[model samples]
Target: MIYQQFQRSPMQTRISGPRAWLAMAISLSLICLSLFLLPFVLLFGAITLGCLVLFSRVYMARQIAKLNQAQANAHQHDHTTEEPHSHVYNSVNIVRESNAKETHRMRQQGRTFEHKEDEH
Candidate 1:
């Protein structure tokens, strides 16, 4: 197998040598060019982002304005049909009373005690 491989071709290697060199040269040149243009690329990217943000903000503001205008128009049209305003009054009253009483009756061997508590 080794001998068969060795017998195949020096011609293919000779042709591939220039092709590989050309490919390497092209790759290196592109890498250098991109490095040189990096700052410009970043500046344009920032400008694009700023424009997008500005456009979005303006669009949102216009949308909000339209919504507010629509609401105002609807409110105006509904004003006549809407119910009249009504006022409500609420009142609360609280009363509290407390009483404590105790009585002791009995004599001699023991005493009897009575206690009472009431609230209203």
Candidate 2:
């Protein structure tokens, strides 16, 4: 009696007819479809990544170009606002100061005569 109570009743057993076959067919079809589409799915994923990288590079280039244009415009604007200035700020009069020590040293060295007379 105790073992009988523990045993599953036939009424509670799984139904195994068309329902089981339908479930198995659906699962098999899903597996087959996924297998068939796997390559396409991978290819599409790679293409999408490539497109994203290409678009990002193009976008970055465009942004850099825009930034360069803005900098150029800003420089031109700033240049226009500034007054025109002369290239020479102040004329410097370079007066050579003769050092007494340098003059004495030159006098001591006398005249260096290394003149080679032209042989006529």
Candidate 3:
């Protein structure tokens, strides 16, 4: 069997710095020229679009976080619906950290150690 050497294409190059700026400039120039003929311009419509974009981003972020948390909990083999959780902190540096680590003790007999949100 003959072995083939695969090479990455120019199109697949990582975008950064000058390359990214050049691409942006080209795209903006194209859009400006192409869309110059479009007649109607409304400030209300622009504002509405901006608000919709902001709301959608916030909504999607919340949804993604919820899904990730559920997936993480599932991976840790979380069984019960009502789990007793506690806010814990390192005895030394309570002042530095604002977000407390949640401590969970598995009620089941086989599990001995503290089961944090990341149960594994």
TM-score of each: 0.52, 0.57, 0.32
Number of the top candidate by lDDT?
Answer: 2
lDDT of 1 by residue, 1-120 (tens): 779879869777765777788998999999999999999999999999999999999999999999999999986876756667742222211212132121111222454546656633
Once fitted onto the true fold, the runs of candidate 2 whose alpha carbons sit more than 4 angstroms away are: 1-12, 84-120
Q: For candidate 2, lDDT tens digit of each residue in 12-106?
A: 55656888779989999999999999999999999999999999999999999999999999879867776777232322322233665655565
| Order of candidate numbers by lDDT, starting with the best | 2, 1, 3
In candidate 1, clashing pairs total 0
Tell how far residue 56 is off in model 3, in angstroms. Answer: 0.1
Across residues 18-71, which tens digit of lDDT does each residue of candidate 3 receive? Answer: 979899899999999767744445665788899999999999999999999999
Tell me which of candidates 1 and 2 scores higher on lDDT: 2
Q: lDDT values of the candidates?
A: 0.72, 0.78, 0.66
Against the true structure, what is every candidate's RMSD?
A: 18.2, 18.5, 22.5
* By TM-score: ranked, best first: 2, 1, 3
